[model samples]
Target: MTEKNKTTNNGTSRRDFLKSASMAAAGFMIVPRHVLGGRGFIAPSDMLNVAGIGAGGKGQSDIAAFAKSGKANIAYLCDVDDRRAAASRASFPKAKYIKDWRDLLEKEHKNFDAVSVSTPDHNHAIIAYHAMQLGKHVYVQKPLTHDIWEARLLTEAAKKFKVVTQMGNQGASNDGTRLMAEWYDADLIGDVHTVYCWTNRPVWPQGIQWPTNKSEVPKELDWDLWQGTAPRKEYVDKLVPFNWRGWWDYGTGALGDMGCHLVEAPFRVLGIQYVKDVQASVGSVYVDEFKKGVFPESCPPSSHITLTFPKTNKTKGDVTLHWMDGGIQPERPDELGPSEPWGGEEGNGTLFIGTKGKMFASTYSDAATLLPKERTKDAKAPQKYKRVPGGANGHYAQWVEACIAGYGKMEVSSPFEVAGPLTEALLMANLAVRGHDLKGGALKYTWDNKAMKVTNFDAVNKYVKREYPAGFELKA
Candidate 1:
């Protein structure tokens, strides 16, 4: 067997593949690894090269994870913010650096087999799509896209291009996510019908009035690139470095920021979907003196959203999920831990209101304990809740292996199929929030995975497509 056949998937062999192909004068321009794999016993490492885009926030941490990754070595670090770039590049002085991610992808990214994009949700699909087109695998952050269409596009591209992928919720790999899934399967909560999940969003910026012409752009930022697919706006200190999560143009608000992680448990373990009915109320919030329209003109600081899943042909039963953010939580169930405090807060977790018993959890509830802790001790585990085997290892490390191995274990916990659907669901919550604003009532939705947008909503169709600012565009 060739050396490439037996080695584990770390990606160093990608260079060898390209070298041998070049020597043979094959004029190869990056074929999907599976094409070569079927002919011979090529391993994933034969394809593991890597680059990064948006090395800040989640992106920066993703870079750190890549640095610590044993499967594949870091080859590049890309970020728009010099401050974040300088910080991330600090560990891998050898990795290449650039301000514009395109330059890295179009010109030098061939050196990489995969790229992790930790940019805001708005740019996630655009950069990830282009990367897949160039034949590189992708690791995009959670709440995968700012809008629903992007989620579908990215998911399809991974399959069409046959590239391995992961969404950067990282939390998805937590023992808690698995436990939540297992619990659902084991009937631990027995027919979970209602779930309450929440987060403290608007943690950054909220209540943006319509944009005015006066905010001064921060000198440190490349406001243009940061604006990437969103429409142009004057740079403001309020919107840079970390605070944009509250804005519609740059972030997905609380739902987009935390839903992927917080709501992830139910989506995966319970198999909930087809969230057909949504009614929400956004609370009061404000735009900074300098910033405007970056967020909704009149936004709520906290909102409560109720989502209903239809008992369609595929659904076993109906499920309703309620989301609360910005310090608001679904009214505490006065019955949790009867021995403990009544009207207790969920803090940040999903509480399953099941038919048989109850389950209380924290967002970090990967190792969550059941309410009435004594009940869990007496309870027996079931088959569906059987521990999902494999890759309890780090998130970035698994991607490294996939990028290197090419196809073995191609399906990881957060692959596009799973993460993409979760992202779509979370983005739907955002849509519901906005729909409540304009429609003045509950918004109904039907998820057509192929279309990537709500099957309804003609006028809101405008909300689904993202428009880019000057210069930065989704590359072909």
Candidate 2:
């Protein structure tokens, strides 16, 4: 057999198939599928080969979801911690395993058509950006990047590379969000001027000091790789696996963890883009009778941030969005009965206040409802948009199929184009949260979207674009 058509023990080689497929698309002679295989057989070229980075926790589930599509091959797996990667390694035994993502991309880029990045918030932008530069499609976890600048960079890169891109906010594809959009379109709720998104998060510890006691790195973990873009620091106990969500160096606090999922509903329904200004009030922890504990390295225990957005084609005037976390919630709307749930059964949800009526939805934008409880019974709106086959769960397959179909060939629910601004808005809210402490008082920060900085307070602008360690610097 010719080298290009060489087969592995089972069948055609993925790398060779990809090469041949590219040539065919470039005007080379096409081979008939039946001639190459039986009538009912599917070609290897039809399947998307995916390389998974951060192959544990959310990463593990993401890989499995893509595999569940039955149209993806988990061709490679890379993780900083072997212990964490164990399950995925056992699940996809054929996928080559590596300790560092940089090495995997360097040595095996030819074998995969896409990359799934579920790494910590700090590392998301760098890994995904590099993969896109190599002309591979990317699926990144939500709160797209750690900083506003990074989010904008990835968005531009997606278009520049002409590669399929998706952010891991599965709710963007859920039926509830689409229904809300349809309802708004039908004027079931008139122009929504105000929105409230709340969640009980920081389930991980926050508003505390970083542990000073250094701990030996686990044998199964690569400490350096885990700290990818963040400043170098000693390894601390219990920081890995989950608790990183509470730290500023590694996580975006509660807003980063849940903002994408909760705020997405109003962002879509109102067609809002970047925020024009943001103000925040944070709950402080008292160390004793005289002093409040100051843990600048950690996120506050609670915060209520307000972001105002300029008017869009869908609204008559500017929109105001309220984001509350750390167990804070908006006042219960009087339209509902006293015993009725406030946000949703879970206490995490989004509420929309409009001129004519109101609407709300649970976390992930699921189970949408109208106000007054009774209004929901007969609410009607035309389903103007197409729904994914399996709703939110279908997010993975949607990206996989879109990658196989090539960029611009298919539509994904949360492409970088839509996700970028959404993420920036959340990060903008965070800027205010952090600024509240930096200013030592409550203050509103005006945003210059074009300049990508805080126009009023220059101190908070430092976070608009963060400084990275030498090796991890993000370059244009």
* Candidate 2, pairs of clashing residues: none
lDDT of 2 at 220: 92
lDDT of 1 by residue, 365-434 (tens): 4546565567767766553432323333477777776677674355466888788777877777677677
Q: What is the lDDT of residue 317 in candidate 2?
A: 99
Cα lDDT, all candidates? 0.66, 0.86
lDDT by residue for model 2 over 185-250, one digit each (tens)? 999878899999999987999999989999988989878778878878889999998999989999
* Among all candidates shown, the one with the greatest TM-score: 2
Alpha-carbon runs more than 4 Å astray in model 2 = 1-45
TM-score for all predictions?
Answer: 0.82, 0.91
